[model samples]
Target chain A: MFSAMIKKELLLVFRDKHALMALFVLPAVFILIMSVAMRDQFSSKNLEFSLFVKDLDKTSMSQEIIKLITNDKHLVQIKEKGDAQFFIVIPENYEQNSNEILKLNVQKSLKENEIEVFKSLLSEHILKARFHYISQSIELYSGKASKILANLEISSDKLYKVKYKNSKKLPNATQQSVPAWIVFGMFFIIIPMSTIYINERKQNTLMRLNSMNVSVFAMTFTKSIPYFLINQVQVWIMIGVGVFLVPLFDTPALAINGSVLAILEIATGLSLAAIGISTLIAVSASSSEQATTIGGILNLLLGAVGGVMVPKFIMPESMQTIAEYSPMAWGLDGFLDIFLSGANTQDVFIDFIKLFVFGLVCLGISMIILQIRIKKGL
Target chain B: MIKISNVTKTYGAKKALDNLSLEIKEGSIFGLLGVNGAGKTTLLSILNALVEMDSGEVEIFGHSLSKEKTKIKSLSSIIPQHLAFYENLSVGENLDFFAKIQKASQEDYDKAVSVNALKELMKQKASTLSGGQKRRLNIAIGLLNNPKVIYFDEPTVGIDPKSRNEILDSIKNYKNFGITVVYTSHYMNEIEKICDEVAIISEGKLVEQNTLENLFLSKDNKSVNIEVVYSNILKELNLKLLDETNIEVPKEQLCELLATLEEKNIMIKKIDYGSTNLEKYFLKRTGVEDV
Candidate 1:
């Protein structure tokens, strides 16, 4: 009996061309589009940075420092004040050894004749009495430092060393877009699956099945198997194609296999959810339109929240946390782990298990609700 | 054989089938007759174990409807009111698929002649098949299950006359093969023609049950006819005061009413007997004339 049900489901899925596009073509299209979009993000490129110097002391040393800072390819010196987005301020006593010199040490790096002129000018000041031994001592150190600096200083100074950090450029839209497309495909395929089941009830097909000695569980599970298999194969094909198109980090087989497994598992669970929802809707509806509308709302809500339309990464942290609660997010997360993270099957074991359990729970609820609804003649 | 006791089904405040008891014998074509919203389909659904009842004990072939649902499901087949095949699949594929669901092995196709013949038609897409052909497919699907009992809910609805006859014949054939048939329909003539016994349900209650012949013969209500220039008299007649079937009016009032009708420019073209057919009988039973 189970075999018969399986055969029936397979036939139904294969017969509809629209279902084929949704299950097979849609996922691959999404993978292609997203990968292409994100292609740039994964590339190896150095980030370009511009530096601006705001020198309070316009000394020859400051000029040398600016030349050195501009030497690195990654860092460019912006001469125009308005063009400079960031500035590094150099304090007047920045290089001073504070322990030895409590005063500003501008004289320590200046010429001997200039220091003597500075001392003679200070002696002739109106506040000569206030020039204590601390001031005289600073002048003596400045005169000695200037003579030493003339010998130690090189003709050209290398003041700053600019090293650029390695960065991977964001992939273009196609590569970045594929995963989201896969999610969309998953959602798109569900429409037919939901309608197929709901239409059965509307057209009295389920009632006919009920009369046929086929258990409800068998019917529901069997119907999902074909969809699961189709989605699994499509996910694998998409991943395989993606590996060739985008410079995927993971091997084709591992990536395709693990991601396929995750996708299939989630598809199965989601299909069960669809069946459960359809059964409940079909009871109240005398027409297929009602069922389709209700199913559409559910698929849309799940798809939107679960990252089919927008990737979860860009969403707020709180939204990402909420997305984890959605079934689609779990599926997408598992796939991404396998594809992008190069994770093995064991990594997705929990996700698959959760999805499987979700399927079972949905099916159980569907059966109970079906019983109640049918009894009430809704 | 199917048996139900104290079955009740309600939707909010509206009772669909209230304390209904019925027994459908094996190897007979039983017709369930009722007006729209009269609980015929509800009763069939319950019997098929497709839905549960509010309070009921149902037994099919000695298996409890609730506890032994799987067994019951295996024993029964249903031909629904609409086409049930996967329109995308060819006829043969559809049959093969349904047969597999019923656990009827393809290797044993030769053993089930009807199913094998149906399978041969699998090349044709279900949507491409004629209406009669689709109906036949529906019946053929039931045979795959090899059910002991089958329910046909308005099986010939919207079908051509020839197709209707063919479906009825097919149903009879099933009965001849000893499969219990529970046929539900609002069409009185079809029930009178095909069903050995008929049961009338009204407003969720089983109002009458007997052989088709006896149900029509045992009418106990006064039949009255009134002619008027305008059809508005029907709305004016307060039908609520009457009992289940008969209308009560004074003789002098009846005469005066006829005289008033004649005095007006109303021409009494003809006066015919009321409550003449199975439909009228149902209306009388339900206490609503506009069937």
Candidate 2:
């Protein structure tokens, strides 16, 4: 009998061409578009930063400062011998008139005032070079604003150095947002699945089926099958594409096996959630337009909360905690564990379990709602 | 045999069915007749176990529709007005799916309803079939389980005359053994032709139930209307006919009598007979005509 229901469901899935498009074909297309759109986001890129330094004093202190800045990560120093856009020179004497005048010049080329700060830092550094060019500024000098101002009028011999280590790593913003899109694509496909099934119920097809021997749960679950299959395929393709495309920026290919498993588990769980959501929409909506509107609003809400549109890392602490309840968040978290962290099955097992429970609860609620609707002739 | 005892269903302030009770004997073709809002479908839904009545128990072959719903399901089949099969599948596939639902085994399925019988046309999708063909397939699906009790709800609603007869013939031949048939329709002729007994419901209440011959006969069997050109002579003739024994003039004739007289040398333009079909019985009982 179960097999019979499944067979009938498959037959029905195939019968409606529009449903097929909404489920499988749309999900696949969505994953493709999203992966392409976000291709440069998560992938690592060969970074290059434009550096500008201004120095008035030609002291060894200024030269050493320039060397430290040049040695910084992926930075190229572009300083002029004269009044370059950024330049610094150390004075010969420091006792009389110890104050240094800082000038930030642009060849009508500089876009922002960071060059102004760059010139100020170099002038201060030349003042410090008049004394001992100390590397550890933290131990020798106080970083207090008042003390720095007082030191500006004192002899260069009292000048203490403030310097940073050359080695530093910076993450690309585009890379951080890329993975979110993959999950968003999954969410994008899922919303329609929810809406279409709701539409079916609004049209009284669900009641018509109930008038036959089909069970409420059977109808609800069968409606999810096409979506479930499509979502799984979508998860697979998006993960695969994400993996392949990430390497374009020299990032490691997203770990495949773990990511795939986690995605599959979350997809199953989310599919149940989708079923529940659709059932609620079907029952609660008095009109098809109302159902679509409510379903659309819900999709957007879930998508945003689930971190499909925002990176979970950057979300506020409370929002991050709240995201745990979102089906998309669970899926995205599972995906992150596998692709972002290279986790194994055991690593993602908890996320899978959480998602599974969420799916089951939602599905159960949906079935109950559907039963009421059926009995009530909705 | 099927027995419905004190079944009642209510929707808020409105009573969809009020203590509706009836018994349908085995091997008998029962016609359930009613107006649009007569609660006929609600009663059927209860018997089919598609819904639980507010208060009542329905027994089919000594099994309660609620407690022994599975058994009832296996024993009964329903042919709804709308087609419910997968239109994407071939005829054979559709049948196969329904057959599997009933747990019909390989040999029994072959003998009962051959899957291969639809083989020549197996490649064609069900959506491509005409309306009549689609209806036939729907009926075929119902027959797949070889149920003893079949419920046909407006089975002939939108079909052409030829296909209508074909379905009727199928229903006629459906009772080779002692299989019960519950046929519901608004068409009086269908009830008159195929039913052994008919039940009429009005406004959520059962107005009458018995063999069609008995109900029509006991109710005077003289429910007919005749229309004629409005003239003093024809109106007088109609008045004289109304005065005949074994006849009753409903309220409409009294209201039309005065206006019907002023004209002269009136010819009978047309004659219409609104004989007491089930709809009349419903109107008489419910006191509301639109429903």
Per-candidate TM-scores read: 0.65, 0.74
Return the lDDT, model 2, position A28: 42
lDDT of 2 at A21: 58
Regions more than 4 Å wrong, model 2? A14-73, A77-179, A188-226, A245-291, B88-90, B105-123, B222-291
Tell me the tens digit of each residue's lDDT in model 1 across A209-305. 6666655666667776776666556655665666675455331222343445555555455444444444445444455566567666766777678
Cα lDDT tens digits for candidate 1, B48-166: 77777889899998999879887888888777777887777787777777776667755444334363245456688888888878888877777776778888889887879988887
Task: DockQ for every model, please.
Answer: 0.44, 0.27
**lDDT of each residue in A1-378, candidate 2, tens digit only:** 666666665656555677555544554454445444554564343333354665455556556656655664544566544434443333443222457443444445654665554445444444444333432333345546434543454333355554423211222332333345545554444345444555556433354455446676677666666556656665566555545654565444544434455556656665555555665665566665677677778777887888776666668999989988887787667666555455566677776787677667767876787677677765
Which lDDT value does model 1 have at A297? 78
Q: What are the chain A TM-scores for all the models, listed individually? A: 0.60, 0.66
- Cα lDDT tens digits for candidate 2, B52-154: 7899888999998878876787788778766767666787787777777566666645533432134355566887987777777777777766678889888
TM-score of chain B of each: 0.76, 0.77
Ten-residue region with minimum lDDT total, candidate 1 chain A: A98-107
> What tier of docking accuracy does candidate 2 attain?
acceptable
